[model samples]
Target: MAKDQTTRICCIGAGYVGTCTSAVLAYKNPSVRITVVDTSEAKIGAWRSRSFPISEPCLQEILKQVVERLAFSTDIEAAINAADLIFICVDTPTVTKGTGEGFALDTSAVVACVAKIVEVSTSDKIIVPCGTADQLRKLITQKNTKGLNFEVLSNPEFLAEGTAIHDLLHPDRVIIGAENTPKGSNAAARLVSLYQAWIPSDRIKTTNTWSSELGKLAANAMLAQRISSINSLTAICESVGADIQDISQIVGLDHRIGPHMLQASIGFGGSCFEKDIRCLVYLAESLGFRHIARYWMADLEMNDFQKASQTERITSLLGPLASSKLTIAVLGFSFKAGTTDVRSTPVLTIVRDLVGRGHKVKIFDPKAKKEDIQETLCKANLGRERAIVSLNAMQACDGAHVIAIATAWDEFRTRPGLRRMDWKSIADGMQQPRLMFDGCNVVDAKYLEGLGMKVLELGRKQAML
Candidate 1:
């Protein structure tokens, strides 16, 4: 199967999925030369320089051992020409406009990648489809391009951004989807061999193409549904004086339901969960299954509601929001901690709303790069005069009339880091009736209340507050 003297591997994208996945492959198989090529020279340079292009743990350590085997470049055609196996790890962002608009997947990059490969290829290469594509269109590309034969195998990545390295090294399961034909099966076997370097044989699953294709979307959809379901219960908890954390603990005890993605927060935000769920909804609607589409779309709708409502909810808590000339402190800017990725970060919606209402928002995130946050703020046309990033945790919360915990960074839980004073100091340094809004429901509200502060937390027993 992949019995070439030296297996050549090329990954077509150097973004989140590409960089992490290709590094793991290179680390596992030292003999196999892996080339990671991206359109962005800056991204390629970042990868080559062995810096954190994306926030992933253990990346530097792994790259140390396999950096020589792995190469990053902007040359796509040359990579395609020399590769026996190519992983199309390009991005498939959710379409934001046009016919499908908000829900459908924008696979323009994947389509364009296929066309380029067809134009350059001289031999049949094992094309492992890690993201998205239709087989019929692939067949058309095959038919049109002379001397271009691509063995398209579906091998989607299931690694989370924060824990990508660990997930790659010790994956719970590995799925390899291929056509039912002999060539497809053989291609799948080659991939299985590559992964078998580290992953247990039992963990690798072989399936038909369609099952593999939908499996990625379905898995993400199910995760989003779980998160939305918990968020939905949060509203009830808030009104009825119940604690979502407590509810989560009680419900999580059920072995069947499991205890993943059950935490109630502002909402789930990342590259995958929301967008992938939208894709599932779009697919259902395209097939005229309107009922099924609505059923699936509900999860995404709940997530959006949770994010959008944060600003208004906080405004309602503080009467005459703008008239009050509120000084707000926001801790955690990234969608989740341990990563600099801020794409679709729920905090964006809240920050925008607050700035629009004339509230001054001071932000602090130990991990989220200030430049990235600034870029996002620039896109939203949020002037630095209103929303600005503070140097440290304490600085952001110093003179704030209200403190909002947006991201669940480890540092947010403690005090001295934020002169968010000791219960004793809080009263003296902070304004009267110091209001704290726990946007993520991550902080200890009861403890904050003990400091003579008025704490409003999400999905918690706050009716009396």
Candidate 2:
């Protein structure tokens, strides 16, 4: 395979990574044919009809442009047989049963895909496994009945939930890892050429197989640690009556610290941070590094503690939850802005506690689907009786004693060309002694206080009581 040549690419698993990657490749390299295969017919159907399963900015627009070159289907075997290169983008979620129950990654889906490829593939192909590189190589080598040569490569994706399209189009850096053999170098160069179509040559990095795999895990761990560190300081700030935002500004000013993930909020969430941290913890523990495991494990513990502490503070302010049947309005349901991913979101913890204590909770998000929110809550064993989904923020805030800003969306803040939320109208409709818990610290607390709403902001002293 050479650059500028039309190569058939098959991506196994039409989830977030697979779909976004296939679309970008198809858009950048129009001559190359790419097909995304998944077992879920509904997901494939949704893509075919332009009804995307997940919400991401600029994703649909790019998908529309590459519709002629990119295809979604349920026929995995046929796509595998016809492809010269295959990408294993299947989900490797943390195992929830048997061995490695909570922390270790479960790569069963990837294992199954390997079995199918080994049975159906008839030609030499470059296999890019996104997870468990060593296990994937072992599985393919053991199951190969025919004399077909397979070159295994580790090409893990580094995509953030909301900015996936931009990350794909102009990634900061791309890591491709393969064996240090002649064939491995050749395969790495071929994939590099595909990315070079749009990405600058300097942005792509090639390394050994283990570094690529570990790099993905370590990158998420580092980001999650920053979030936990800032949150841990928020507790001290509350005790000392010092503002966390001020501290963040001063600390982030340091050239070494920078100002990326230093914002103090309720906690970090989404599919990556907590899951990847746990995987790292498990990896350390498995290697007999007890101290190392404990250090990484604290990041996850601090995240949970931050969420629980915020819920406790809100509930304590309401007196006894059993005595007061207060109506609370939750402003956001998704993990963060620009995406509708509810996995491991902190809002779930707060709302679950409120509803379980007999308080009514009304939730709203700009882009999160009502069904997705309901499903997430239901999976957590949270009943829907006291937890309701509102059509708009106004409906949720009406007759509510407290308004909780869970997700920090740009619309919630005052931005140019965007109409700010009508807090005066919302405050007027809310019940007396109205309170606003700015979990994300997006709005101006002083401004909200002027509207006669008591503001309780995270990482700040409680003085507006």
Candidate 3:
């Protein structure tokens, strides 16, 4: 591939991963003609617009710089035919039913994309499995392409939602998993060259196909496991009156453990962590490693328990749910701060549990749009209009008996105005003896108690009257 020549790169999916990856690639390598293809026209349209669909700070400016180089279309065949390197970035969600329902990845779309690639591409082009490699290998083997020649490479992306652009721009490391074959190694090298524009060559790591695939899953599992471990300790901290934050900070200061993803909150939530962990567990079980599977499964079970424990705390503080028709204010809905993604938000789990017991919920998040929250709630088979989406933090708190801070958005923590906003204004706006449940441990329980409001903070004992 010529350095100055326009290297055509086509990404199969236009979702979060596909869009962000394509944008960054275009931004980094202006010479590369990056075309992002998706089945959804709305998604493509959003990408074409100025106010891009996703709200990541500095993403719009970056997109603007490379808008000319980047193209969005629903025409996959045209994009694939003209592309020198094709990235299969479609969703490989967990299978719901069948033999490998819970654990195995559903690769129907990946297969379809591969078939399309085989049909269209004339030259021996590199086909990179941007998705997980293990699942793609199964599909490749099943198809049995004895005649056609193609280079398959595994180049997994490790970008979080909120900080995807930052991660992509300043990646810690770029993993390229290729076969020992010349063609496979060459393809991996080609992909590495693309990232060499921004990322250091030394940061680029190479490994076998299986190792790369399992590495992605293992990385996420371990990140989530750390969170679950901290949360599990939060329970003991609450019982023993120990400060979870202080404990986390002190433990994180050690060079071995390090301080990252240690901040205690409701639980871990995102598209990757839980799904990947479950996939890892399933893979282990299939390989006759039952003990390994059980150990991994325990991490997820602990996560669920942590979310459920919050609901239990709410009921314990607020008294019986049968007689009290309490109005609950949810501070945040998105899985995490800085992004509007609610893939597997612990807030949903908490809301479902509360609603199941007949409590009304009112939600508010600065970044999360109304439609996104509504769609998430609808898909979860929860009420749509039952929860009112507020414009500001104070508005959401108004007219609510209890305030549950689920997502630890920056505004939830350091905003002086949020703290100063009279709980009396909230109380007068609602029923008497207002309750506040700090699910994220962002609020100061002492301050709230001084305001004469019943405050229950996670990883701490309830405030005494």
Most accurate candidate by lDDT: 2
Q: Estimate, for each residue in 1-465, the C-alpha lDDT of model 3 and write its tens digit.
A: 553343999999988788888889898897889899988898888887764777886788788888788999999889987888888888888899997898887877887888778767666567886565555555656664655556678878888888889999999998889888886777787888888998889999988888888888899899999999899998899888998888899999999999998888898888889889989998999999999999999999999999888988778766554357777889899999888987788899888887887778888887888888888889888875566667887788777777888998867663466653455466567555578778788777666666667777778766443
lDDT of 2 by residue, 17-38 (tens): 8988998999999889999999
Name the weakest run of 10 consecutive residues (lDDT summed) in model 3: 414-423
**Global lDDT of each candidate:** 0.81, 0.87, 0.81
Angstrom error at residue 47, model 1:
1.9
> Candidate 3: which pairs clash?
none
- Count of backbone clashes, every candidate in sequence: 1, 0, 0
Winner on TM-score between 2 and 3 is: 2
lDDT tens string, model 1, 79-156? 998888988888788887798898888877787777777778877788875555464345546555475556788888
Structural similarity to truth (TM-score) of each candidate: 0.93, 0.96, 0.94
Residue pairs whose backbone atoms clash in candidate 1:
394-418
Candidate rank order under lDDT: 2, 3, 1
Off by over 4 Å in 1: 1-6, 135-144, 320-322, 415-429, 463-465
Clashes of 3: 0
The true-versus-predicted C-alpha distance at residue 195 of model 3, in Å, is 1.0
